[model samples]
Target chain A: MRVYHFSEQPYHGAWEADAPSLRVTLPNKHCDPKVAADLINWRLDEWQLCDELGLNIACNEHHSSATCLSASVNMPIAMMAGRTQRARIMASGYAIAQRPDPIRLAEEIAYIDVATRGRLDVGFVKGAPYEISPTNANPVKITERFWDANDLILKALTHQDGPFSWESEWYHFRQVNIWPRPYQQPRPSVFVTGGSPGTAKSSGANGHGFINILSGWNARTLFDMHRLASLEAGHGVTPWSKFVYTALMGVGETREEGHRRLMDIAGYFRTTSKVGEAFMNPPGYMDVAGNVRWLKANQTRGRAGNHFQAAKRDGEKLAIGSGVGTGLGVSAQDMADAAIAFCGTPDDVYEQMTEFISHAGGVGNFVIMAQGGEMPHHEACANLELFSKEVLPRLEEFDQSQIHADTEERVLSQRDEG
Target chain B: MQTATMTVDHVGIDVVRAGSGRPLVFLHSVGGVDRDGAFLQGLADRGSLTAPWHPGFGHSELPGEYRSVGDLALFYLDFLEQEGFEEVVLVGVSFGAWLAAEIAVRDAHRLAKLVMISPVGIKVGDRETRDIEDVFAMSQDELTEAAYAEPERRKRDYSTMSDEDLTALARSRESYAFFGWQPYMHNPTLRRWLHRIKQPVLVIGGTDDGLLRSGYLEGFVESLPNARLSRIANAGHYPEVEQPQAVLDLIDSFLEEE
Candidate 1:
């Protein structure tokens, strides 16, 4: 497994339980520029440490929020490209739907890929529902827009023959010719992250990597959908490398200490749920069926009133049950039981990971949120150091190729018999 | 009252019709419409009421190609032509009013008069401020409060509703978002074309409308060549629902004017 160290780069100092929200509604006056600068510099230093420690690096973007400082994902990737040498850098990812200019994004990614010397894995995401209003993007037809943008960006990156004219429902370009073409021949390895089967199917059909982040039991189902879609598209069974899983991770000298550290890191979830109900589920963000399900659930829970009451009710859920897939668990045991987090001594953490991998069929990339919430810089560095030294070698030794080959054989035999 | 599926341009449109006289087309707001509602009866009393649920609102089949208020307005124009209506009186509420304005702007020759109730289609505020409250952004209860002078009077118990009712509710929400999400509720360039509508217009607004500011109703009157403004007390966005008699009185007087 190729384990990638990731952090949301959260500004934990701004987290206040009484605050209306930590996201879109939170005013900029709460954000201290000097402290933000220090935090950004510290996080950068930690990413540099990952390079020396033999761990791959991953970056993600969020906007108009104190939860994540990385509003523009490209800036960090470009910054890391010049600093890190061997580690494969990934953005999981840029919000394609909200971005108005795909051609400009194409140029920026191309420059980053060239700078990284072809060591880049590009990831495109649909962004958070709460960000719809903040980005001033239409929530309707967002998925359609995302696909078009994705196609346009790829075309821009690969078409080196000459300028091309492109026009679609959501975007229009008179001429598309991006300079500094990607260093990778065909294009850089692409990854897409989402929680829905439709998204997984699209990712697979497009022959792109799929990342399932803390989706719990549903992660395997989403991966299988991706595999089936790829096969149906006549692309052959997708390899283990095409599937990635993300979770909060922590390690320490003892099992109890590791659990404690991970619990601390999981504080990220506590702050994340502070979003107001008004922005929780914007219309058209979720599909019709999904909205119906959510509405029914809320009504059943007697939380289907005004915004404040609904937000409070959801906050209660976040403290307990809703944390199953997300890292909002009240206890270390809750997180570990859900398999959305791995924490303990090297041996314990390794065993938990292998168990999860077995349950998931196979996952080649493990995206680890090493630093989250109020984790001090020194603590984050120590966690990374221990994980790299003790667990990385064992994880590298575990081969997915044999497992995948066996599964393929079993499937073929079953098909023949049927 | 009768609900029939009328095919226009190969698309199914659910039209509710009642009474008979000079054709009065009733366009509903984002909340869809109640075919059996008392307000619709008041409209029937006024003239031959022909209320068709906008495509994608209720049982109407939403054409994939139709994306904006302009498209819906054009479809409505076709509906009027297909039905062979003359001296048409166009009456619309809320989002439907926006459609009516667009229709009048396009072609006012067939329309004798226009009535817009609690309309939201034009931007009257500065760049940073929005003229209409974002229905998608607010909570259901918040929206209820904004849409009704007495919020409790408009409360709906979805749990008690039938499966079809619930599905219709969800579909209406989805359709509303699809049409109004971008550029919000107003067409930025629409204000420029208001002069094209020469038909006498009566713009009705709720005095207590939380969705619209005071000046928004006045702005519509000022833009139209032959138009006037009236307000209904004890009502919010849907004046006809809260104070039907008052709104109907104003409509009756306007229609009777020589």
Candidate 2:
């Protein structure tokens, strides 16, 4: 599997337990500028290391939050685009709905593609619920804006001349034109995260790649849908490997150490993750049906709300079980067991990941998140080194080609039978 | 309030009607309408009141092609024409005021008088500094604080709220965003078109509206050729909901003009 290294680039400093949300309500006192500077530099160094190691660099973006320090995902990508050669720059952000100007977005992506000489994978999302309001983007019209922006951006990139005037509900541009043409024909490859069937269909219809970060079994279902969509869009026998799978990964000297390290970080995240009802799902963020499904899926009904209640701004951290793991009712070990957390010795991680890839129907791109929450920088680096050296080369032979060939044969036979 | 269902432009919608006499249409704000408020009855007591839920809010059907605030104005204009109401008085609150102005600017021959309560369609200054309060950015408690002039009026026991009430509120905000999210609660070009309105306009606002501020309301009034401003004391965003008798008193003067 082609592995891409990713991190949320979490700020591990003091966080207020009583705050309504890390995104909107949390006071900025928790963010020390000096600490942020160090983290940004460290993250860049790590990404540069990934490039040297012949691994893909996946950069992420989030706004108005200390949960992730990378507010602008493109800055790092643009900076690295000129520097890095072999590694692909995955700008999995510039959130479609939240961005006010899609024309500027198209021009920016094209600039990046030129900088990277075409090694760019554009990642778009409707953005997390918290992101909607901070940008003052309405959740009700997010879908409309997303589709409109994507269509407009594509038009701007594909066509050479545009003083193209188009009117839509969300955007109106009298003269739509962008400079710094993309390195790739038409544009760089487009990838979108799929948490819902709607996104899967959009990805399929647009003939774009689908990435499932932690959907587990649902990833396979989405991949099948993507394949069907690709076919309907007249791109036949589309490689299922284009659908990438990501997991929270860590390697330890022993199994116990592995689980403990992951659990410690999981628990550290619990305080910031105690999202308020309104912040988590704002009014009108989703339609009636979507809201119901979201509420059900994220039922904090049994949450011991006061579990992490601490009098100080730096609240007393709770144990793993009584912490963030409780939000999903899954322990660190449960994550390992489910392949959501690939933590163990190098050999153990390799075995678990092979099983993960096999279970995912053998996706080509296996994205590994080595750093998250409060994991120590040195330990995370060590884990990555071990993973690349000991585990990376071993999985090259594990093949999904047989399954793909068989599926292709089945589809052809079905057509013949018809 | 009595709810009525009808089809306008082949779209189903639920319109709330109250009072009897002249066919005066009362358009609601972002919250749609207040149930336990006396404003509807007060309006009904003076004249026949008809308030159609804007397309996509409450039980109203949202047309697939429905895009801009202009569409809502056309939807109501067609509704008024289809219903055959002649010489109708237009009254609007907050977001509804913007829609009323949009319709009145397009065609004001059938419109007799216009009343805008804390209207929010004119940009008083650069949007960064003088834009309307972003209720979406506020936490629930923060939203409550910024919305009301009275302490008691600001509080609602959400724990005891019914599912229907909660759902309706959510739906209201969604539809509110439908027309208002882009231009961000005001039309940048709306101020230029105010002179086109042929009706005598009454611009009423609460002195303590923490959102748009009273000066912005006056700015809307100043734009119209035949508009006058009136301020209500000890009230907030929904002065009509807070103290209906005072708002009705203000409406009486404008309705009496013709």
Candidate 3:
């Protein structure tokens, strides 16, 4: 398994501000440019460390939000490609649906592919719900828009003959041609992030890799759905390597030290859930049936309410559907139990990761969020150095064939249930 | 009021009608007007009244091609032409009023008069100013307080509602967001064509509509050639529901004017 080092490059200095939300509505006046510069540089240094450690690097984008300072996914990828020599860079990824100009995005991707010397792994996401207001994007049928944008982007990347006109329900281009087509022949491997079975199945059917972030047990069903859909679409058996799972990880000399260090990084989950309820689920972000289910759960079982509040309450395990490592009161034990965070000494973290991969029926690429929230730069570097020295090398020795029988059985059982 | 499905332009629309005479078509707001509700009943008692759920609002079929309020206006015009209605008195509430204005501007030969209650269709303020509150950006409690004169009367307890009721409400909210999310609630250029709606219009505003800016109704009336502004007491965005009898009496008087 290949491990990718990741960070949200958060502006945690604003985490203490008296704002109703950390996203969208939160004014940027609270953000200090000098602090942001330092945070950006710190994360870049961490990505460079990954290069020396023989680990891959990943970055994601968000807008009008203090949670993630990387507003443009391409800028970081471009910078890292120039700065790091060996790390395979991935964007987890650009919100293709929210971006109005798919051609420009395609051009940038091509530029990055060439710059990275064919090391770019492109990922397309349907955007977060809070982004609806910032982007002024219509939430209804946004998934359809995502697929349409994906089609345009891929066509723009590979169509090298000449200028071409393209028109779709959401996008229109009079003359479409990207210069210096991708360095990778045809295209780089495409990945998509999704939490729903429908989205997973569609991703598989489209023959793209699937990435699930902190979804916990529900990720199994999502992965299974992707595998089954791929098989049904006549894509043959998809290797376990096509699936990726992202989680937070911290390593220290002692168990207590690791747990304490990780609790600081877990601030990402706490502050993210601090968003105003208005922006949490915009109308039409989910379909009528999905909204109804959410409403029912929210009203009756109190399941769909804010994780921030739930974590504040003493001793309530975060309701299902929550990404692991979420909420303010989540402990190190809770995170390890949920498989959202693997923290401890090198041996402990390695054991936890191996067990998680085995239980997941095998995840080929494990994206580790090494730094987030208020984690100090030195602490982050130390954590990475320890992980690289012990756990990462051992993890490389794991072979997927060992779990092939169990994964096949699980897939068949899931298919039979379906 | 009688409820039925009307298939227009190869799509189904949930329609409610009552009484009989010169057709008085009533277009509903975001939450949808009930067939047995006091507003429709009051309109029905006055004349033949027809209120149809805007596409995607309730049980209506929303054609994928339909994106904006303009598409809805066009569909309504086709429906009126197909139904062969004449001298129709068109009335609309909130979002529906936006559609009514669009339709009148496009073609008002079939429409004898127009009534717009808490209408939101035109840009009444400068670029930096917002004439209508961003309902999508407000919490449920905030929206409720903005939408009602007496917020408690309109506050909903979802636990008590049936699945079917919640589903319909969810669908209406989704449709509302789809139509009014971008460029907000007003069509930027609708103000330019208000003069094209030659039919006399009665622009109604509620005394307590927190959703609209102070002079929004007056500004809407000023853009028209023959339109007047009126206000219903103790009401908010949905004056037709909050003070149905007063709104009905105002419409009754306006329609009777020679």
Candidate 4:
């Protein structure tokens, strides 16, 4: 398996106990920049360590929220690309919908790929509902803007050594030209991440590398559907290497320590997350059924609600329909039940990850977000060390060689039948 | 009243046409078809009235090309010209008023007179001017509560609505976001072009609307050439629906002022 290290880069500093939320209401003065500056440097150093330890590193951009300090992933990713030598720097990635200029973004990504000497993977996400106010985006056009920018950016990137022009419902440019093309020929691999069937169909039909954040029957079903769509494109099928399975992971020297690490992730969630439905997801971001569920969750919210639904907040409600990340309130037990998170000794974590991979129908890229919430920098670093030493080696047995052979055999048999 | 399908630019729209005097075109607000209440029938009593659901709102097919309020304005102008309606007495309400103003500024030769009701266009102030509310962010109940003098009078409960009504409302909200999402509600540069509308105009609105403040009505009236203001008592955005007789009287008086 192609192992990668991922982190949302939480601030991990103290704030008001009952601040309502980590986003809009939380005062900016509460952010200790001196502490944050050190934290940012420390986080980068951790990524550098991961690179030295022989692993890929993935970082994401989030805005207007204290849950993640990565307001802009490009600058940090570019800086990290300059610092690291071996590890592939992937951004799970920039919110294309929030960006007004796709061409500027294209040039930035192209330059980063060059800086990395061809070790860049560009991934795009639709974004959280809270990203609306910061981006000055109309929540109604979020999906439209995302796809519009996606189409324009791809065409700009892979324009056959081009100076291309783009005109669409969202944007109109007279000329599209970039000074430096991508380091990787024909551009680096492009992937779009989403958890819904609609997103799955789109990513599959477009032949994009589909990375699922969840692993289970839903993931297996998504993979199968994607494979079928790719095949229907006459582009064969999505290669096993193109599928990424990302999960929250925590590991320690002892079982109790691992459990504490897991709960720390949950504790970080309970204190920081606000359970407001409209703030998390405004209207038009979801479908009719999604709105229904959003309403249902909003109705059931408060002290007397189910511990599972109330603790995790409405952030996880997005995950219920689409396969994005889990809500912070997700306990170690909840994570284990869904097989979306692992926290234990090396062997126990290894077994859990292997089982997750099996349920995913075998994926090539496996990203573990071991650092999140209030997990101390040293603690996060230690968890990574345990994971690298114990879990990383055992993952060698879960590669796609067998799946590739099986796929080849199936294609040949189908050809014979035809 | 008669209702039927009208095709414009290869897209089908449910159209309501009534009365048989002079042709007076009525462009509706973003509230969509259900806003076709007693006031509309009153307007039809005086003249030939033609009202179509805005494309993608209330049973109207969503054509991909109908992306902006500007597009809608251009389409209505084209419809009037194609149908050979001369000296059109045009009436626009809320979102539709913005469309009417767009058409008038671009080309006003065909319009004899124009009336705008609580229009949402022309940015008057950057900081002091209150913004149009984020209607798409609101629930159906919230929308109804803010839109009418008495929310219960409209009976716009989501639970009571038919599947068709609910779907149409959802689509209308989508259309609202598509047209007015970025600029919020008012057009940034439209204030400068208000002088281009040469037709005699009447700017009318309700006194008490949660969505619209007094500044919007004042700003709109002050910017226009050959314009006058008429306010309805104890009404919100849909003054015509809330106080139909008062609004009807104002329209009748405007028409008589030849």
Q: Top model by lDDT, which number?
A: 3
lDDT, candidate 1, B55-142, per-residue tens: 8877688897888999998998888889888899999998999999999898777899999998888988899887898776666788
Model 2, docking class: acceptable
Clashes of 3: 0
lDDT for each candidate structure: 0.82, 0.73, 0.84, 0.73
> Sort by DockQ, best first: what order?
3, 1, 4, 2
Docking class of 4: acceptable
Task: Please report, as a residue range, the 10-residue window in candidate 4 chain B with the lowest summed lDDT.
Answer: B155-164
lDDT of 3 by residue, A1-418 (tens): 7789899899888877787678887889999999899999999999999999888999998888888998888878899999988789999878988888899999999999998889899889987787766668888778899999999999999998899998788998999989989999999989997667777899999999988887665566678788888877878445678888888898899998888778878877766655666777877777777778777655321222253212211334553324323465557767777777889898989898888777777788988988987899999998889899989989998777867567777676766787
Off by over 4 Å in 1: A297-329, A410-418
Report i-RMS for every model.
3.1, 5.5, 3.2, 5.0
Model 2, residue A360: C-alpha shift (Å): 2.2
DockQ (model 3, Cα): 0.60
Q: Each candidate: RMSD to true structure?
A: 3.6, 5.7, 2.8, 4.5
Best of the two (2, 3) by DockQ: 3
**Which lDDT tens digits does candidate 1 get at residues A1-418?**
7889999899877876346667777888888999999999999999999999999899988877787999888888889999999999989988999989999999998998888889888899987777777668887778899999999999999998889989788888888999999999889988898777888999999999998777765677787778777777777777888888988898999988888789778877666656656776776777766666665544411121121111121223223322212434357755666666888898988988887787777889999999987898999999999999999999999977777876555544544555
Off by over 4 Å in 3: A297-316, A319-328, A409-418
A310-411 per-residue lDDT for model 4 (tens digits): 112122332222111235434575565566667788877888877665655567787777777677788878888888888887787656666666754564
- Misplaced by over 4 Å in model 4 are A12-21, A24-27, A138-148, A158-162, A168-170, A267-284, A287-330, A403-418, B127-130, B136-155
lDDT of 2: 0.73
